[model samples]
Target: MVSPFEAGMFSGPWRSLLSLREDVHVEETAEGDLVLHGRWGDVLLRQPDPVVRGVLNRMSLGPISLSNAVSGHGGGAHGAAAVLRVLDRIEPLVVRTVGRSDGRLLVSVAPIAPAARLRPEPLPADRPIRLSRFAMVRTDGSGYILESPLSLHRATLHHPGAVRMIGMLARATTTAEALGDPPDDRLLVDALVLLTAAGLVVRGEHAAAPAEKATFAEDTDPALAAWSPLDLMFHTRSTLGRHDHDFGATYPLGTGRSPEPVVRPAADGPVIALDRPAWEEILGVDPPLSVAVEGRRTARRYTGEPVSLRELGELLYRTARVRSLVLRQDGEEPSASSRPYPSGGSSYELEIYMTTTGGRDLPGGVYHYDPLGHRLEVVSTDPAIVAELLENARTAADASGTAAVLLTMTARFRRVSWKYRGPAYALMLKNLGALTQTLYLVATAMGLSASPLGAGDVDTSARALGVDWRVESSLGELLIGRPGTSSGDTGRLPVNDAAWAERAAAYLGVKRGG
Candidate 1:
């Protein structure tokens, strides 16, 4: 049922009716009469009674109708007079229909009083007012818009005086006397009242009180702290379907060229062909999935022993090898390749690059893992750059040892952006997690040491790799080598549990062990 005026009117003296004896009840008779049974006695309004009919009809139409009926003689002069008298008696009562019973509408009547209107108080000449810290304001061609990040509230001020006043208030707190004189001052006071009611402004003294800053960190995932806003926005708008334009409208598969370099063997340059080892033989001696899972631990301290090139090749093939490529028909989607780890929209945007320091067969240089060719393409030969990369990997893993190999993960953003929107970057990160987990499990299965780093310096990696940061940039790092064999003692390696706990506590502002 629709409410007459959006809100119910308050009842005053009629509130006493609700406190009547518990046994008191109102029932309608088949003869069209209202019977009120109370502790004192029973009161009945007879059927066809003009006063009662008129009152009920006017009440059904709402208070506004009742007022109109009282002023007009449409209900007949005598009937109107009766309605007015009945209304006077129920002036302290709020009458409304609760529902319908059998064939008649049920009525609810209670006592209430009108609510008081808010009155604006004169602004103090001494105290200054400023916008709340939680409020954000911007100007458009049409007007000045005000919004509060703390709340989903927005206000637009189009009046020049209001805009000027808000601009003044935004810079710093100012009293009404300092805002200007006469009309401007009046407008400022009125605007202040409106803004105050909207929770956009606070008194300068109150705003100065120390309070925890309103932050999006409370709502955002901690793992996403490293994500840039531009990247996030691009990912969100491209994958989340929030943009106005149609997304995924066209098949994005073959739209853009692959960013991977074509590996044409150089005359003298090193291009190591990754041996395609038989997996059946490897699995015969490999531990069970359950055993592998249980044994998978992030190894921080590695033995100084160098990892064999065959082991590195096997690891890359098992975890990241492109199993098959599917090409689409004309007017259909383009082409996509499948890998062991699942990817967002089958857009395997993750690319692997490795820096080998003390590998048995691989030289100390930076190389890209060619998943399609099952080979490694040497990208950099500078010893200093390789040293820097190794140092970063060690720092990330928090281990002291000659890192046999370091894997740097980068993303080809357009691969996912072509078909997805805002959630593209997030999906890429998810793919990274899946790939990392796969690496951990496979490393365990192979009896190799592997440690996934929580973060890496993107700019430094980009510079060392000589790759355009926009096209591709490092997203994660992983260190791999032979596990240390020193009496099961991990030496000075960073403990993720403790570090993570400390960071978490700091973010939440909670004292540890408290």
Candidate 2:
């Protein structure tokens, strides 16, 4: 697992160099404990001696051969073995490197998962292999990085030659085939071992030495068949138990202060004041939770009646108005706010944009909802663009004509992005669902026809809302109108009958209790 770049010429074999990540540093505590802190997290050794500290200090400076770093420098085999155990404990903070025979570092692999044990193994010399469909190589601040949601570790490509080395992996090419003119360049072979160990490369069939022989280009896999590439990527990156990126209020990109304001300021325009509904009155008049939950449905057809301004006011007041703004960043907590719907870390980053189309009391235009003040700020009054915004929502909901009132939900990206790294966009989607459900239950109780939309065009809505797409973009949409004449409700039941339960249990190959 530990091979140091031997201090020699390019004629020698390639080796794995081990060291603590450059970002890692050592801090000796007052209680004589040693703290090894890095970008991943901090680990503490109860107490350590001078030699261990010396090796750690040397590791901070540059990559060293684990063997040479321990046994070669004053410390004997026993001391080196002791240090190796220490590295194993803090393995997440360590980076494994492989240098070409020229003594130039080509690629470095770092553990991303908590239980990751990165050790490169030789590829099957006979078979062809390719990069996993999920694996991606993007230009990072440090040249290029190859990472996959499936990978337990992330690999950074250091040399330009290494980048070219991976290009050979795009298609299923073998080791002997990849060997270039001099037949001495082991860069491709060595990198494949590390990348394969990281689960970024896959071959046609299974092998015993590797943990996973990613079945590449196989027939449709039932487990992964339904997922699109983008959908799968988003699913993994947005939640924990997968890849490692800085997450949760770390404020990785900031200047000490909270990057976003406690409340999003209203766009510049004349504010159209709306009547704020009293919470006590809403509580008394609204239907019980059981009734609203059971009654909620996607009502797409809207009666051809002008949606009253009062209806819009009541809906927004109950669903999304800012109840309070809590400034906790002064004490090092993230600044948060209160709304009817819940958000991760209380980051209410989603904004509501109401499209005024086929309305009675309100003019036809797109307006931004100012939740803090319970007012609507006109964003675009143009008739054509307003119609386009409404049309898009109608299409997304698959409704006829125009929606009585179309609610477009846009997320102030930085508001959540500032507090979260890997899970920011995923949090935005979760917040969208929370608000959508709130609207559904409230709309059901109030007797308004509501249909929650699954999609919205970011650029189209951004232009209509007069906001920068990068700053704030649409995440969800909903259509509301007067209840249309009902022929029949969609087939549904509040409780499953005995027969249905038995059938479901049979299909799942489980015995039913009753």
Candidate 3:
């Protein structure tokens, strides 16, 4: 059916510049007149007076359906009710026709109330993610309602101008009765383009067009440059957030729709695996290291000793577990959003799992770290995966004697999806980086080797771990093992400050600082 917006445009009397012509010969003969041959009909738009052209050019109704145009011909096959279905998206307004122009329907748009603009709702700022809503109204002053993107509510001001132009082409009729069917793609695209050009509408990232320019700096490592730009951009933006703030939110349906997730015990065990003394030592540190300016980059190589299970437990607790709960003064209990480590939305969606290679207390197997209970739920007892795990990290051979392979997974993006809507992918990457760093620092402080592996057969490894794709697929792999000899393959490759300098130059487009 024709949308109300289209009907309003057709119920006008401004001017028509082009019409449809079917026959090839007709196009040849009607060289002067603008003839448009569409699936609906052969419409011929006559050249109008200067004032009329000015109004017609400014008044655009798009890309509505061919069905609507066919119905607008005043056919009697269907009653006004059928026509009303097409104009479902339109609202109430008045139409006028002068004596000689009786065939023309001049509709005038009613003004909107000021209060409608006062609702202070949060709008999406970034591209890709968008939040929108819609509604419907009836033609008989009573009919089945329709729904539309709320953006239309703000675009209604264009109604008066569009209706005036459409009135000139068709007879005055109810929104439903005037237009026949909704416009097809050919019509809709054209109309939408014009409407957008005229500032009557705007669209989010469309699949049809090329992507926009990069606002965030790109990753300069050529090895990574070929990876999806979307992924790179997401990571870059997330890294920046880590340097600037401790948390961000990802609420897909908005805070209004956020419901407390029912926490059920998925497994009963310590989220960490470690020897009794080592675990005690980790938890008993005089004071856990605080993330600070000078401490951010103090990463160290591992000597290949097993990382204590106790240390692993402490790392998980400090990085993601819920630390406390908060309440608001309004007598409403607002859940605390803080985590051991900062997150985008107080959503501790990152899950920690381990592939034990040679830990003192944990056996050679796979386990899921249950933070709520602080125990490891053994998921597997296979040694093959440990080999695959080493190859993925490009260090399985080197990490053999080190503790266990710690893998981090991100879930609950829906938490941020509640708010950011479209930017969930970017937000997820950001969370990974922050959590990876948290784990790295914790491992480093405890005198364990901390290496973050960015490349891996994530999907395959995740399946072996018995985790859902959502919880395990998107990840930032961090391997904790005994520190190995830096004299081996690590030194074979020529290490120079120049390589880092070039990468840094590409990242910030500036020379290295003193």
TM-score for all models, in order of appearance: 0.56, 0.81, 0.46
**Which residues of candidate 2, in runs, are more than 4 Å off?**
1-12, 23-57, 74-91, 180-184, 206-221, 253-260, 266-268, 278-285, 325-337, 486-494, 497-514
lDDT string for model 3 (1-514, tens) is 3333333334433321121111211231243443334322344545523332222222223222223343444433343343333223111111111111222222211212111111111112222111111122224332221112221122221233333323321221222222223322122223333333222233343322121322212223456456563454345434432111112453435557445341224664434443223446545542234422112232235445565666666666766555564555664755444666777656555666677675667677777766555567777777787666655664532344443565645455444555564446676677878877777665545444566665656586766776667533646667776555444324445555435533432332221110
Ranked candidates, highest lDDT first: 2, 1, 3
What is the C-alpha local distance difference test score of each model? 0.59, 0.73, 0.42
Best by lDDT: 2
Q: Is candidate 2 or candidate 3 better by TM-score?
A: 2
The superposed Cα distance between candidate 1 and the true structure at residue 277, in angstroms, equals: 2.0
Best by TM-score: 2
User: Compared with the true structure, what per-residue lDDT tens digits does model 1 show for residues 1-514?
Assistant: 2222221112221111111123335566898886555433565656635555544544443433333343443455566555444444333233322221222222222221222111224455445566665566677675566655332234556456555666666534545444654434343454565465444665544332122222223235566556554554455445522222235524345555444422212324567898777968775656656656655667777876777888888899999988877776663543678898998678888889998774556788888888888888888989999999888778877887765888999987766666664456677889999998899878767767688888898888999887788978788889887777434433757654545533432322232111
> For candidate 1, what is the TM-score?
0.56
Task: Give the alpha carbon lDDT tens digit for every residue of 1-514 in model 2.
Answer: 5532222211336656777766788898999888888765788888775567677877788776655566556787566666767776777777778784346898889877777776555666656677787788888775898887667788899888788778877766655556543345766567777778677877666532332333554325677677766788788887777666766777777745456676776577688888877779777666567656655657767775776777678989989988876766467543678999999878788889888764556888888889889988887779999778777777888886555888889888888777578888888888999999999878767766688777788888877777898888889888887656554534845364434433432322221111
Model 2: which residue pairs collide?
Answer: 4-65
The TM-score measured for candidate 3 stands at: 0.46
**lDDT computed for candidate 1:** 0.59
Cand. 2 Cα-lDDT = 0.73
